[model samples]
Target: MQLDDALHAAFRREATGLEGIDVAVYEKYDRDPCEPIIGLGPREAPIGFFGRDPGEQEVRWGEPFIGAGGQKVREGLYRAIHGAALPDFEASREVGRLAFWANTVPYKPLGNKAWPMAVKRRFQPLMAAVLVDHWQGRELITLGREAFLWFGINQSRETRQALDAFWKRDDRFETHHDTPLQLENGHAATFRLYPLPHPSPLNQTWYRRFPDLLAARLESLDAARRLG
Candidate 1:
């Protein structure tokens, strides 16, 4: 199946639960279509950020990764790949890698809010399907703890141990010595699973080194590809 079609199906399946939520407030406001919270492009593309909600008073655009955080993420991506403040997609396209973005949840939660654990659980499988179908079994570079947890890669005793070590050492990307965590679907993949602090302005300290970290990860991917 084409990745977009797969995503559409997965999103529909996952978002079925949203219909049951008390959307009375949303109904009071005009019911415009919820914009897609993910973007799918070629396999080699950079995946952008996907948040749970669009800002108030903003027109919902079709693509994911719009607004201030999107802008910062774009800037960071450009700096990482080309050492520039902005990426010229036309130029980047010539280098043979493209970028795509997706979110675990496809709809904006009520109150411009964080997703509930139950909601997140319902949505995660669809998100995983999108990742697996689109990336075709490639290792993922998840951006934050939420993404890691949503992708089902952060539930091991070893991972907890690693986090404990990081707490003691005050290191961000603490090593787990290759721990394996099982996903809902029972398919397993091993990843280095770097734990970045969230990129939100609320966590400005984490955002400072975000670009460099992403660049280094990209470089590692390149080196691994060469070795393979």
Candidate 2:
């Protein structure tokens, strides 16, 4: 009946087919295999962030977007809401609670590779429930190309085409656009999406500027007014 119940069921059906999963990564972090590794952080949070998937840090912390790249986004949010530096990673989880979070693939993959399209398609419906039925926010800051494009999954053909066209725009990352989504549960809503380059330290092109870009994205939401 609950979203977690649905996610676990789906994971159970697909677990055997989920290839390239680094089970060692989960074991290294002492993560429970039976526990579903996805969901919104705090209900009705003002901001929501969708990422490509979990990494070592996320598996260890048992929270999406709690890794290095996630920390960058959180620092920007902390600065926007409190006008002060977050001080340390010790507060990263609490800072992350300021918003809702999810990912394309809830679990990590081997060698940090993104999930294949078939896998994404298989889980798209469940992720849709997380966004449409669980998250109360009307907007999301999508990190990376995969995360932004995941919105097109399980949507109407028109919406898929529209999201693709929007991604082609040169200004896609600099501006926010509204996209409609429909879930199997009959939930339908349009969420404004602000795309941002993934903040992974290896992404030399945008890594350094990620914080500044995230600040602009939050300002676009008037995040200060709605949060902390």
The sequence of per-residue lDDT tens digits that candidate 1 reaches over residues 1-228 is: 135666576666655546533245335555443333455556654332333434332224434444455555555555555655565543332332245556656566656556777777776666655655455334444555665555443356766665455435455543322335455667655444445545566667777777666666556555223311
Top lDDT prediction, candidate number: 2
Each model's RMSD to truth, in Å? 5.5, 2.0
Which residue pairs overlap in candidate 2's backbone? none
Error of 1 at 217 (Å): 3.7
- Native-to-model Cα distance after best TM-score fit, residue 138 in candidate 2, in Å: 1.4
Worst 10 residues of 2 by lDDT: 32-41
Residue pairs clashing in model 1 are 45-98, 45-99, 46-98, 46-99, 46-100, 47-100
Candidate with top TM-score is: 2
TM-score of each: 0.65, 0.92
Output candidate 1 Cα RMSD: 5.5
Per-residue lDDT of 124-153 in model 2, one digit per residue for the tens? 887787777777887899998899889888
Runs in model 2 lying further than 4 Å from the true structure: 1-4
